[model samples]
Target: MTHPLVKRYNLAPHPEGGFYRQVFRSENETSSYIHGETRPALTHIYFLLLKGKVSRFHRVLHDEVWNHYEGAPLQLFQLHQQQLWERRIGGQGNEYAEVVNAGNYQAAQSMGEYSLVGCTVAPGFDFADFSFIEEPAMKQWLDIAHPDLAKFI
Candidate 1:
């Protein structure tokens, strides 16, 4: 069955898993300072996750903020320099918005049937700046460091 967000936003399969549609892209370009290059100032997307689906661990060059719009709560996990942080993005959680820092490995999934969320990226998002942690490498890292945190991936 198609989720309402999938239908409304014309979301497509995202490399990270689940579905997403790019809804906004800034016209102005800005220097990242860190990247030492000019890029879109910002970008926005509508992201959807269905039950049993998870957004695989990945990292981007720019910070991302997620806004809970509707549906069930979503679990977001961030692996930062070997530290694991968990946050719920919806429902009765203390926060409805969460930020994932640039260069940190992050992932997410729906707690129920589905979750409709929005993501905003500063410095925009380019495929060239995206990196996915392969399962093999992740398993190896988890085996020695964060075995208990593997479930989030």
Candidate 2:
């Protein structure tokens, strides 16, 4: 059976993983400092990750802030400067919100049955600015440098 929250939010399978529904997109556009291109000022979406599913490592040209809403805590993993780190969102003693800076690779999964989070992107979100870590060399590097986190890829 489909998850109740997935049905309630009318989410669709995301290319990266899990399910999501875009809830807001700014009507205004501006030149993005990070991308040096004109884009929507902001965009928001509801992202849900099921226990067994994963949000594959990917990078975007804009900063994304994730806000926890319900269900289990989300284990957000980020790769920056060849370092892998994790942040838990929506659990006791964990942050309610966390940010993934532009150009940083990130992935996530639910710590329990499910995790629902609200993601807000500055300079907006466009598939054109998104990229998955599909390079064989990069995967090999991750395996060597952070074997534990390679599973996320």
Candidate 3:
């Protein structure tokens, strides 16, 4: 069954898995050296990850901040500086917000029924600036580095 939050937000399936609805896009634009293009100063979206679904590992050119809104805690994972890091957002003993640096590979999943979170990106977000990790290369790296994290791929 579809989660009520999904219906409330009218979210659409996201390419990375789960569902999302963009909530904000700043009208102000800025020239980003990181992206080499002018883009909205900020962008925000409501992201929902249902039980048993994962947000596949992906990277963006700008930093992303996630704010947990409701539902189960979200287990967010990041591959940064060749190290694997895990954080639980929302619920007991978990933080409400997390920041992922630019260029880090990130993924997440709900710890229970579902998780509703908001992601804010600086310099906005564009499909051109997003990319999923090549599975084979990521797998090879995981085999030598953090094999346990391979499930995220």
Candidate 4:
């Protein structure tokens, strides 16, 4: 299947598996069919793919700027370091995504892994875009949300 957006911002692995290996990654850990490199122009960049319903409790470590490149709509959530104002991000399609307020939104697209293009005001990125919820709930959600995909991650 050919996607126009893919052609629009064409990027490939510098050396197949280079980035993954550098981070000691695995197809199991992150359901990444392919991982995009760190953008030079951007201070921090992480392009990842999740197989199914993903509910994370983490928020942007810093003020984040994001755009979805492919896949389905990604839900982004955040609670500022010292504020209670919550934010949510969701829209249809992957053609363009730039949410002004970052908060507690579900990156729940239909199916298939979605591409998330984002950079934080701080380099505290990488896996820094994380939120850890308690067990049982997290685990149970994984089982029901992403039956097949959950076992691997």
Which residue pairs in candidate 4 collide?
57-131, 58-130, 58-131, 74-107, 75-106, 75-107, 77-103, 77-104, 78-103, 87-103
Candidate 3 achieves a global lDDT of: 0.90
- TM-scores, each model vs. reference: 0.90, 0.95, 0.93, 0.37
Per-residue lDDT of 55-91 in model 3, one digit per residue for the tens? 9889989999999999999999998656888999999
Tell me the deviation in Å of residue 10 in model 4: 15
> What TM-score should be assigned to candidate 3?
0.93
- Predictions in order: lDDT: 0.86, 0.92, 0.90, 0.37
Off by over 4 Å in 3: 143-148
Which parts of model 4 are misplaced by more than 4 Å?
A: 1-42, 53-55, 77-95, 99-113, 126-131, 134-153
Candidate 3 shows a clash count of: 0
Q: Candidate 2, after superposition: displacement of residue 94 in Å?
A: 0.6
Candidate 3's displacement at residue 128, Å, is: 0.7
For candidate 4, the C-alpha RMSD (Å) to the true structure equals 11.3
Give the local distance difference test score of model 2: 0.92
Say which prediction, candidate 1 or candidate 2, comes out ahead on lDDT: 2
Q: Could you tell me the TM-score of candidate 4?
A: 0.37
Which candidate comes out best when scored by lDDT? Answer: 2
Higher-ranked by TM-score: 1 or 2: 2
| Model 2 / residue 95 / CA error / Å | 0.9
Best by TM-score: 2
lDDT of 1: 0.86
Residue pairs with clashing backbones, model 1: none
Candidate 2, residues 1-153, lDDT tens digits: the string is 999998999999999899999999999998889768888999999999999899999998889999999999999999876788899999899989999999899999999999999999999999989999977988998999888776688
